[model samples]
Target: MEDRNNNNNEIYALIIGAGISGIVLARLLAEKNQKVLIIEKRNNIGGNCYDYIDKNGINIHKYGPHIFRTDNGKIWQFLSRFTAWHEYKHKVRAIIEGKEIPIPVNFTSIDTLFDTTKAKVFKEKLISKYGKNEKVPILELKKTDDKDLRELAAFIYEKVFYHYTLKQWDLKPEELAGDALARVPVYTSYYDGYFTEKYQAIPQNGYTKMFENILNHPNIKVQLNTDFKDLKNTKYKYLFYSGPIDEYFNYRLGALPYRSLNFEFKTLPQKQFQSVAVVNYTSKEPFTRITEFKHFFNQKIGQTTVAYEYPAAFELNKNERYYPIPKQENEQLYKKYLQLAEKEKNIYFIGRLGEYKYYSMQSAIAAIFELVKKIAT
Candidate 1:
């Protein structure tokens, strides 16, 4: 690989990926009068959050539903400059035993799905059962010395977590990390809101348009269908990579574990299909969740678009990388890669895949802000 720093006043940074993180970073650099070049492997920009009109002329998220929610005041303000906001609060429901229950398995769901009197008794029993432990792994309940708690936990696991995870990732509960279950918050209140972020909304048009606006500045130039490996020998002052870090290094140590996603998109001849933007199937379904695009966009139409999302193990040739598997083995492998990354000068890794961590869109934007400050200072 050849490294050349641009001494001229033009093209100060070269960014890979064209994802939200890359685009945001490029925008920041452009604002500072630093010329930027953004290269994307895909034909279009916006990375995983990209949306487009499908064959039926319906707006669909090519990857999956990416509802923007954040508590960060700065990120929300920054993104607002790119596009008009659509006031859309996301809600998710889970299909359990042929019954639709509000997701996060809240108090209202427990009452509506079960016999109201029995539900009340069960809630009290559980409170008395667990007692003041705000957060406890449902699996840990199974290993408890008490046989009753074990049976209860087993029931909840089988009915709630087990089949959902299996259908979602094609893995049994035991195959998954314990923290996976812990990441899901079980609420005792009637709050069915999916995210508790202070700010929650989707782009008025779509995420792609927002990105187009972000990268539209004169200082930034975008090259599509270009991979980082193709630009290895090219000269640039600095390289900001947002692709898989392991692939960037040619897996010199070993491949970092990542989860991939398969999206099955379909069109329905109706104004609306699902009750909410997303409906998660907690039972033994082939797909994990089904997302309706119209809900997110708040569009009134005769036809609607939806996607069935399935999470699976990452395969080299197939499957776009989704989540990074945060197991001990993967973390150890990533640490080895991190050591190698430190030695490589003028190359910065940003975004979820580049950092080998699972980050939401809000988090990704936050990371970009931090990275830009570091680079500029």
Candidate 2:
């Protein structure tokens, strides 16, 4: 990695990791006439959100399927400036008892899983207790006094939540944070959409292209395949790190727990493999979900690509950190790291691994916007 000449051009901000948070922050600061230098350990710029057109002309998400959905108009508008959207609302299904059912346990799912009379009674009871179109967590629903509703919750827990949670997080639903478990709620209505956000979309070109456009600024300089540790004695006014906060401190304060994923990609000589973009394996399959790439933008190619996601333990220097394990003890450890971080000057920890939080695409961008606001103030 070639070092930048600080005499000719002084870097106003040095950003680690060219992921969504780092790229967005670089763009925001560059717009403010700040000279930004972004270094990424990976050769790619978009990090885990990177996508490319394969031999079949299908846009494949390298890591996994990421459906951009958020209620914030500001985040939507901000991303819209870079690329047009596909206007996609993601849908998911899970195989239960040799049948494909919509996830989040909707009315259709209930109708498919149970007998006609029982399904009708369950739906009516759900609407009466939780109101129509409302989402109820399986854990919360298990506490209901209604025997039928409790039965329904138990069925969902055993068939949908239990085995899948065990495979995804290596823990039960009750072990995770409340908000984490509530992510897949049972809708009271017939809505089968996976996400309920107002705005859900994917970039028209690709996420990599959108990121390329984001970093296409005069004041922003990007260096790929360059590790932060290799850049010794680099000078900058401010440092914005989007990598793991624990790794930055050399693991003196203990390592935070995270869940990693291994993807097995296959190019089948067929038009389509699945009905939807993603399908969860809630039963005996060791892998949690499979994603068909061609379904995302409706690519009209003869061949299709799919990825089977296998969740694994996040071993240091072995695999990529995908999810921060949400536990009370993990949060306490992160707070200790936060205390040490707060003592530093002009250095900010951002993004999922950096802050040790589970953040969606929009949430990550919103966080960068807030960080920009703080810097401006």
- Top model by TM-score, which number? 2
Model 2 Cα lDDT, one tens digit per residue, 1-377: 02233345778899999999999999998888778999999989998899998887889999899889999999989999999999898899999999999988899999999999999999999999999999998889999999999999999999999999999999888899749988889999889999999999999999999999999999899999999989988888888999999999998799999999999999999998999999999987989999998888988878989999999999998998999998899999999999999999888999987899988899999999998887786
TM-score of 2: 0.97
Among residues 3 or more apart in sequence or in different chains, the pairs in candidate 2 whose N, CA or C atoms overlap within 3 Å are none
Residue 363 in candidate 1, Cα distance off native in Å:
0.7
Reference-based TM-score, model 1: 0.89
Cα lDDT computed for each candidate against the true fold:
0.80, 0.92
Clashes of each: 0, 0
- lDDT by residue for model 1 over 1-377, one digit each (tens)? 12123347555788999999999999998887777899998999998899887765666888888889988999988989989998878899877777888877666666766777767865665567565324356666667676544655666677778888777656677777537766665564667787777889888878999999999998889999998787755566788999999999898888887778888877889888889989987776678889988777677878988888877888898877888875677888888888888999888998988998878898898888888777666
TM-score of each: 0.89, 0.97
**Model 2 spans with C-alpha error above 4 angstroms:** 1-8
Which portions of model 1 show Cα errors greater than 4 Å?
1-10, 55-57, 125-153, 174-179
